[model samples]
Target chain A: MFEATQLNRRNETTQKLFRLALGGMTGILILPVILILGTLIWKGAPVISFEFLFTGPTKGMTAGGIFPALLGTILLVLVALLASVPLGVAAAIYLSEYAPNNWFTRAINLAIINLAGVPSIVHALFGVGAFVIFFKFGTSILAASLTLAIMTLPVVIVATRESLQAVPEAFREACWNMGATRWQTIRRVVLPNAVTGILTGVILEVSRTAGETAPIMFTGAAFFLPLLPQSVFDQTMALSLHLFVVSTQVPNMPEQLPYGVALVLISLVLLMNSLSIALRMYLRGKKKW
Target chain B: MTAMAPIPGRSTERSLAIRTSKLNLWYGTFQALFDVDLDIRQGIITSMIGPSGCGKSTFLRSVNRINERLGYVRTTGTIDVMGQNIMDPEVELVQVRKQIGMVFQRPNPLPISIRDNVLFGHRIHNAGKRDARSEEDGIVENALQTVLLWDKVKDKLDKKATALSLEEQQKLCIARLLPVKPGVLLMDEPCSALDPKGTEAVEELIWELRGEYTILIVTHNMAQARRASEECIFMLMGKVVEHDDTGQMFVTPKHKETADYIEGRYG
Candidate 1:
């Protein structure tokens, strides 16, 4: 009865065939990433140097470095982090811990989902209308970073809420039964355990914010400005915009210049992602049931 | 200053730990507890025994008001702890909980150091009045000693409480409640998650805790109820069928349902 029949053999072969096809699809997904990284390193490594990283672009478009653009990207990501992390984490705590089971809370959750689904280009337009024009911030770092913050808020909120919920309900009950108020339980127990996950979400947001070109294009990112921004109110040349300018907008640009900028930008994102992964692993090892 | 304050100078043994009258509870439209009028005496181990969904656990949760945490739950009744109606709108939940502690079916130690778990209640209840580390240490040692866990854990008080064995974790759960000096402790099948050995160890600890605190525990294990508790309550279908001395109830139950339940005819 346990011996494989002709039908069983056929089923086994079909399963193997399906596994091969799925494996091939996954290989296809990974192929481009390897190719992209390989090409960038091969074509762009020579252009990366202390001088290339530290000096401004010269010779009618691209010959010097992407120092200002690199600095601008860092500033934008930092400012966005400052603006979004607190707001997103607080909103998540309210939604996950305090919000009653009612239609108003459901409506707010629905609105958050819809906001996350709105496209980057739409966010750019909204940012321009709200911060740049209506709020009179003008085309500045403040406007662009605010736009990025708004774009990534849902990521932080969702990750934070998920992590907060992941903390066993028993822990909250233990606290509550010990005469703890909800705020006391959340402050003492919930937030401490959820912080690592929240940081991972914020880091993921940082990587995305660094690579986004559209939302910051009309609001803050400049095409070819070589001067470093002194304040949030100053127009800055971000790496994403610089890569675009060197690749398409500028005349007589060097062949390796755009590749070099793209390489650095991707590396920064990869670095943030690796940091998040390392942090998550380290903290998870320390965390117990 | 609060109206929920206890009446002074009542004899401890005769005074009620918990008294309920016409307690009706519903989860949305489904009623889970119906007219549960019970007098759980103070400073004694009273075990409630029943089948699943028989409202033994519900009655225990209702005493501490923990059932209201489920947003759908609605209760129309009075649960008086220490001669004060805890269901009164004027009574603060924090104060109610401070006077009444609860332990769950599964052992739940906070993912914190053993010392911190022991001190968690004392810290919250005494917020803004920081105690010296030395005094806190004494409190921890005393509480752990009471639960018979100090010898095994005294050397590693700073280690995570979750790292302990199941028996130790349940003991720690009991120990954590001691620092706050709650007048009543409600446990819902606290040994149900343990192995036979662990169950015996926890039962001994529960037995050791009687007379110092009013102990009301729910159990599925009839043998445990018979051996560990002084008084026993039997409930079926959300209503009490019997409440008597453990010896009398086990040997000569007043109700047919209680006898059938104890004799293992049906849960």
Candidate 2:
């Protein structure tokens, strides 16, 4: 009986040790994120003002504001989403819902994986070759947005496929048994259920597209634009590229300007991620079966 | 138990509701069913009893072409439902599904409200044809009432169907199919996930639906088969070993294998 009690005590101690190890690891992982956000807010909070957000930059991008850049980033994200969401979702539906288990499907899956792994700089070069030069869209917002869209297509496809597959197969079967066609099953039951996951993917893509400087740099973003882009064909200043320029290329730039840009970019991403998370929670609450 | 008379509205012509001729199925290289020939009559409850992996569920799925969803599955032979050969190249899947409804081992209602769930199939089948708001309300009421779920859910038709107990969810699954007006219902171990009370409640509801729809139920429960089905089919090793009236099959099975299974000597 004494030995049994001793063994139980040993098990409890080991369990507590395991829990502590896991908690410690979590804290270690989150430390960098907290430090980064804390540093950005401390350095950049005073520079963020309403006029700074809504006016064009002045004095060689050293003083005035980043409104054109901010608007350009939003436009870039919107156009990329418009280009990729429909195509990516359609491809995902084909892969998850209709693709036969054959070598062809396997090849498509491999292509998607490889496309995702390709570097952002390589995608920018491809955009220049294909969209800017070949298609004559020129070094413009359309070309840059197309490059970003292609780069992010795999993310959307992967997420959409996972969520579509996550929908219980039984739901499809039930709908089909009631004489609903395959498309109808997807439209009425599968898509509605998977919408939350799909939206999360799109939102994540928004943050990713917003912060990417490499793909948009050579393809569309200008070092400094006096006025905002008026059309898809126009080159525009973007927040990420603007931060890069002000921090590295410009001489004697205000110290807080780059920090403020970084702060806004990160905050926009965080806000979108939070919205996706909230939507997921709401949808999960509504899900039955 | 005494023999129950055939329910009213049953086809007096004694026609077959479902007919399978030399039906065989395989999942890739693994054969799950072999030469399953069955002629299920219209408007009666027929139960299929077998041990696990005996191809009872496989047979039911084949009738509705649900097995084709698997990429490697291959089926040969013909399935005729309501005089139309479903295996024919020209027969649309939508039409076949409209004629047959299915309930699963577990209830699977959409994440939508209960009323929407009931009207889902009807809306799909009648796409582009607008129904008056009141007519839709009536359709929803009639289907739920037939499943005997209207009273419990009437006050909150807008509530999500998943919030209900398992038994109610199962009933809602059945109610949802009714609005589509399927002539046959395929039940694959419908009560396997339910408690005894839920099973009894669902079984009673199935009995209530007897006169209007033909039902083919696959169950592991021999007692359920004997009590609920008017006719019974016993299968072993993916082959039908016996098909007879429920009373006859339970009292005096013709084959030794059937007798052993009924007498609890073997699965």
Candidate 3:
């Protein structure tokens, strides 16, 4: 009995040690995220002002503001969402609801996974090949938006499919037993329950599309377009590309200009993410079962 | 074959609501039901009783084509509902479903308001037609009233159907089907998820719905079958062993197998 008690004490100590190690590892994992956000806010907050946000850049991309870039980022994300949301959601619906469990469906699932894994630079080259040159859209917002849409389609499809699957099969069976067609069931039952998850995907796509510089650079983004884009066909200055240009390409640029642009871009993405999270919380509270 | 004509009072062939001739079903390579032939009457409660894995639920599902949702499920048979062959290629599924409503082992109310749940079937069947608000209210009230649930839930019509007690949810499920005016109701162990009180309440409600709709219920509880059903079917190994009037079958089971099963000798 004494030996058993001693063994139990040793096991307890070992378990406690393992728990502490796991906790420390978690802290280490989160440290970089905390440090990055802290440094960015500390360095970038003071540079952001209404004047800096609202006016156009001046003095050879050295001073004034990044309004054109901000507007271009917004436009790019909007058009990207417009192109991708419908296509992605439709594809996800087909994948989750209509597709039979066979090799063809498996191949489609594999393709989505591989598409998500492909490097951003490779996507940029493909975008240049397909959207910029092959389709003859030229270096314009439309081409960039299309490129970004394709790149983010996998994310939206996966997220939407997961949410669609999360809805209980019982619900679908119940609706079907009531003589509802597949489309009717999806429209009235499935889609409403899955909307919050789909919106979360769109929000993630917004953040990703807003931050990408490589694909948009060759497709439509200009190094320093002083004028805002008036149409889909016009080239525009993007925040990601502008930040790149201001920090590296332009000589003797203002010390805080790139920080301000970074701050705005980060803020935009964070704001979108926060809004989607709040919406998801509200929807969850309203969920009946 | 002596067990085939166990029910003495009612003629088996007359006024049939549903008839399955040489019914066979398979999930991929494995067969779940084999050569099932049953003549369910037009307006009575018939209960199917069997041990687990005996394909009673599968048989219930096949009546309304609900089993076809699974990709590998295949059925070769003629299920005629109200003298129309549901297996025919030209028969639209929505029409078949419109004529028949099903309740699952677990009560599945849509995650919507109680009022909307009642209107769902009517709205689906009558897609292009619009009803006045008062008309819809009447439909909801009448259906809920029929299920004996309106008095309990009348004040909270807009509340989520899922928020109700399990017994209420099950009753609401039965009530929702009434607005569609279906001729037959298929129930697959509808009381399996409820407590004793819930089961009793739902059983009483099912008994109340006896004459209006032909209810074919599958139950494991022998007592429920004896109390609520006019006729009872005993199945084992995916084959119907005996079917007869509930009183006669319980008092004088024709087959030795039926006697053993009812006497709790073996599953």
Candidate 4:
């Protein structure tokens, strides 16, 4: 080992380098988010207009609106939430409340964490093959929703599970002692206490579903779709897909409207995020859990 | 059941509210309880005092089967509450739990208004429907009054339960337990998490409710055992070392271990 005096210079330099490296890493990780958000506001804010928002896709370099896309995003997210909320939350309840500390429960939990890390594009492909080709539903809103549900299932499931876990064991005991049946306990005490957390998870998943592009593109994406969906089977437009189209395809002409859509999309994401935060806050406020 | 209130002046009946015979529990392969037996009489306060991890809580959970939810924990032997074997497959745990309520070591108030928190058990059990407003009001008042929390919390009943001080929250939990009209009350170191004043408040409440139901309390605080209980049971290494009148146990314990513990020889 070197003497204290001999190591002083190198140690000092190493500490400075470590600090610099940390700072550098933080910037690198956060740069894209800041840039994308900044660019969206800067480029998209001006394009916000009532008229542009009401119209449909235009050919070549003409002014168009995000009404169809917005409608589609809402529908797709709603359907996905509808499909996944019950199933994912139920799975979470099983994992946390019902499942034992056995290998089976552990395996299921591990699979869910892994599912969350799976690529969105892979989910898209699964949706296309399963819902569209094998089920013969055709490339439509139904396919897109199924794909998005699978994509967001992990988020909602984990959130629900975490919320359920957050509940004190005493609460469950209290419920049981109150003569509540098992399902009754889950429905009354456990679920009600866990609701805010579940809702938060749902809101977050909604935002995630809204932002996805490649998945939607894979299942039911149409670059210039103009129609509103009437059913799950009807092909529809969505906000995220439209934003991708506007950002990459029509960056030159009527630039303001796309930016407007970008701003709207950003607002939508922020709104969902804020909603998730609010639900979680409400969940936390009830205190017992 | 006419659970409008505890109905004061009703003659306290003599009965065994809970009985346990040769109870044993295992955490994985580790034995937590070894052939333990206990009896909780109606309308009396029974205190369980023991060192930490001496199966006091393990014994408490067996009362309501909350231990069943914990992983790899197994139990053998019979636990009878109100002459019903809770361990019987046909016996409904949730139903059994309702008959015997519990207050935890830590105060746990649901994230809701004080009113809703008090009404929690009532609403869940549907003891009285929402349309039964008069019964609801009476039940709420009775439960709150039993815990001596009525006057302080009445005005702010609509406020969130978390808004209350820690002592108030503990009282609210007691109030919640009241609506169940339970035959027996199990308190697992209920005052352990409270300050001296809060502990005194809970101790007073326990005495106040004694005539209405049986009470079993687990405590690590020796002075509390001396001050608050009539009959006290002491356990060591998951075995009941001694059981006798609280004053006698403290003054002249039956076992040397109990005497040594009273003198702080070994905890």
Candidate 5:
């Protein structure tokens, strides 16, 4: 009886200890996210202004605006979306809907899963090597966009595949039973049903590309673009690369300038993130029953 | 029993909605169906009844070539629908299935509104007749009325289909099939998932649908086979045990196995 009572007491203590440990670990994990956002607000809020958003890059020692950087970011993210959305979704449909449980399909899926886990900086290096050097885009906005497009392509494909897969097999079978051709079933039934999921994935990939700094840094992020890109052929300075140069690597700049660039970059990312969330919510609202 | 069966020696007024000659099916190396010969005549409910894994559903699917969609499944021999060989590589299954509609065990409605669910195939095959179809919303209304779902879902035509009750959904599936204007309806245990009331509704629909569509049903319920169907094909171990009119098969089955199955001796 004593041993039994002792065992129960020990188990209770251990269980309570585990709970405390887990709770603490969760707090620890959340600390960085909170701290990151908190610091961005603290350091970046003061520089927030209408002129800072609208005006062009500074001349000489003037703390000027980030319009050129902002333009590059917008153009590059848009280009990436245009490049990846259709191809990623098509690849997803092929994998999820068309590919049966065969070895070739399995291998292709495994390859995609592995590709998603490859480090972001390596993707940048590959972009510089392939797009900038080989393709001879020569550090232009087009090259940066292409690099970012490749980086986010895998994310879009995986998300799209999952969404397409979520469209119940019953729906496809229903289409088939109705005498719909295979392609017709995909177009009329499956694709429309999975559109929301596909849209959500595209938004997330767009978010990812919007803030990516390292890849653009090597491939197309010009140190100081005097003018906003009027065409894809022009070199451009994206906000992420600007934030990097201003905050950490600006060798001969005053303290407040980095804060201003950091503010603009943070705002851009937060906007993209919020837009992605709103898009998904709006889609969910439309999904009746 | 032999005397009861008029068993015409030589008759040639051949009329079959669907006919299978030595139907065999394989899933990889394992055979799922044996050499099975069967015919479905018009204006009657023919049921394939057997235990689980007995390929009753397989035979039903064979009639419409639905099994061919499965990558591992392979079928041999000829399944003829309306004198066209469904097994032939040249035969367009899309066209064949357009004439033979199916309602599965579970109700599956297109995720669109109730109106769209009924008119999906109608719009597909009958596009040139759209204005006529739209004017005759009566086809959708009448189909729903026949399935006993018109009263339940009459006001919610534009509402999402997934919100319906299971019985209503099942009936909607029947209503959905109506717009396709199929001559043969295949049901793979349509009422197996339903409650008593839903089962009764489906049974009544099967009875009500006598002239327009010939039905091939797969059922585990012996009483359903007896009450709902006119012709019965009893199968076990992937082989047909007996084939007869439901009344005769229930009363005086020639095969001992058939009698055992019908008499609740064993499946």
Candidate 6:
């Protein structure tokens, strides 16, 4: 009975065929990533130098380093994180811990999903209308970062809520039974456990913020800036926008220059993603429950 | 059993730790408790035994106002803890919870160190006050010893509480509640997650805890009820069938349903 019959043999063949198909599909998914990174490094490695990374773009964006753009991206990502992380985490805590299960909270949840679904171009338009024009910030880093923060708020909130919910109800019950207030329970028990997850979400937001070119295009990012931004109110060049300008908008731009900018931008995002994954693994290892 | 820090407001005037009258509860439209009237004595173990969905656990949770955590749950009638109606709007939930501690079916230790778990409730109750490390250590050792867990876990106080075995975790859960000096303890099948040996250990700990704290435990294990409790309560279909001395109830049940349940006719 244990011996393979004709039917069993056929079934095994079909299973093997399906496995191959699925593995091929996964390989197909990874193909573009490998190709893009390989091409960027292969073409861009020659252009990379100490001066090429730290100096401002020269000769009308055809040459020189991307220091201004690099600094601007960092500033934008940091400011966006500052604005979004606190607001998102607090909103998540309220929804998860305090909000009564009612239509009002359901509506708020629905609004968040819809907000996340809104197009980046629409967010760019909104940034122009609200932060830049209406709020009188006027095409500055503050305006762009706010737009990015709003766009990524849903991500942070959802991640935080999920992590908070992942903490077993038993822990909260244990706290509440001890006469610990909800705030006390959250601060002592809930938030500490959820921090690494929250950090992962924040890192995801950082990577996304660094790559996005549309939202900051009209709101803050300039095609070329002679000086790096000194404050949130200043317009600045970003890596993503610089890559775009060099690749399509600027004339006589070296082939490797755009590739180099793209390589740097991709590297930054990947590094952030790696950091987040590492952090999550570290924290998860430390946590027992 | 060493001298515990005196919990303020532990009045010895009243013999009854918890008194409930005409207690009715509902999960949305489905009523789970029907006129549950009980007077659990102070410093004794009272075990409620019943088939599933019989409102025994509901009654236990109601004592601590924990059932209200479910948004759809609706309860009526009064539950008095230390002579105060906990359901009264003027009564703060924190105060109600402070007066009563609960252990769940599964051991739920905070994902924190053993030392931290032992000190969690104490710190919360004593907000903005810092206890000396030695003093805190004393409290930890005392609580753990009371639960019969100190010797097993004494040296690893800084280790994660969740890393302990299920039995130790349950004991830790119980130990954490002690420093707050709750007037009553409610347990909902606290050993249901444990193996046979673990169940016996926790049951013995509960037995040992009697006369020091009033503990109301809900159990499906008939033998556990008989062995651990001083008084016994039997309920079926959301109504109490009998409440009597543990030995007397098991030997000769007052009601047919109680007898039928005790004999394991159907649970």
| Candidate No. with top DockQ | 1
- Writing each residue's lDDT as its tens digit, candidate 6 over A19-91 gives 9999999999999989988999999888888898899988887878999998898889889999999999999
Query: What TM-score would chain B receive for each of the candidates shown?
Result: 0.95, 0.94, 0.93, 0.93, 0.90, 0.94
Off by over 4 Å in 2: A1-26, A275-288, B1-8, B128-130
Writing each residue's lDDT as its tens digit, candidate 6 over B1-267 gives 222223334346547878899999999999999988988888889999999999898898888888888889998999887667788887788877876898999999998999999999999989837699999999999999999999999999999998999999999999999997887889999999999999999999998887778899999999899999989999989998999999999999889989999999999
lDDT of each: 0.90, 0.89, 0.90, 0.81, 0.82, 0.89
Ten residues in sequence with the least summed lDDT for candidate 5 chain A? A56-65
Q: For candidate 1, write residues B155-213 as lDDT tens digits.
A: 99999999999989999999999898888889999999999999999999988888878
Which structure is stronger by DockQ: 1 or 3? 1
Q: How should the candidates be ordered by DockQ, best one leading?
A: 1, 6, 3, 2, 5, 4
Which should have the higher lDDT, number 1 or number 5? 1
lDDT of 3: 0.90
Candidate 1, clashing residue pairs?
none
Error of 3 at B218 (Å): 0.5
Write the number of the candidate with greater TM-score, choosing between 1 and 2: 1
> What lDDT is obtained when candidate 4 is compared to the true structure?
0.81
Sorted into a CAPRI-style docking class, model 6 comes out as high
Model 1 stretches with alpha carbons more than 4 Å out: A1-12, B2-13
TM-score of each: 0.96, 0.92, 0.94, 0.84, 0.92, 0.95
> Model 1, range A228-257, lDDT digits (tens) per residue?
888999999999998988899887777988
The numbered model that scores best in lDDT is 1
Model 1 chain A worst lDDT window (10 residues): A56-65
- TM-score for predicted model 2 compared with the true structure: 0.92
Q: Which residue pairs show backbone clashes in model 3?
A: none
**Could you report the Cα RMSD, in angstroms, for every candidate shown?**
2.0, 4.3, 4.3, 4.7, 5.2, 3.0
Can you list the residue pairs that collide in candidate 4?
Answer: A44-A259, A44-A260, A47-A256, A177-B97, A177-B98, A286-B111
